[model samples]
Target: MEALRVIVDPPAADGGRRVWVGHETVGLAYCRADVLDFLRRAGLDPERVRLEDAEQIEWHGGGPGSWGARE
Candidate 1:
């Protein structure tokens, strides 16, 4: 199984929050503690951004249900 990465893109239209996939050859998910620690290290506020679970992402549109009509 392939792992997925999640990230925060800050505020924009529609509350400026978007849930999307990211590419990182290093690990599956962005370590939560690491993000928190980074924010602390950078003297930033964790509240400025929100991180969701990205360890196990589900791609629900690639199975038989997605098959096209046969000629």
Candidate 2:
């Protein structure tokens, strides 16, 4: 098993995904911009970090497209 630095958990009942940076839970992101905001507040540069980067983001149940429940 490997430790995920940026983990985006499966969507919740409220159609939001839990964004985790390291061991801290940033917030529940409902959209791509929300996720970006979490990363920005975590000290990650938005210009350098991309949401499509698989190596940088670990998406669980579903990727960015799956926000309104697990598909």
- Highest TM-score: which candidate? 2
> What tens-digit string does per-residue lDDT give for candidate 2 at 1-71?
55448999988897899999999999999998899999999988767777887899999978788887533
- Model 1, 1-71: lDDT tens digits are 43334343332333222224454222221234444444444444556534332233222223212222220
Instruction: Evaluate all candidate structures by whole-model CA lDDT and list the values in order.
Output: 0.34, 0.86
Model 2 reaches what TM-score against the true structure? 0.86
Which candidate number has the best lDDT? 2
Worst 10 residues of 2 by lDDT: 62-71
User: What stretches of model 2 exceed 4 Å from their correct place?
Assistant: 1-4, 69-71
Quote each prediction's TM-score. Answer: 0.26, 0.86
The window of 10 residues in a row where model 1 has the poorest summed lDDT is 62-71
Counted clashes in each candidate structure = 2, 0
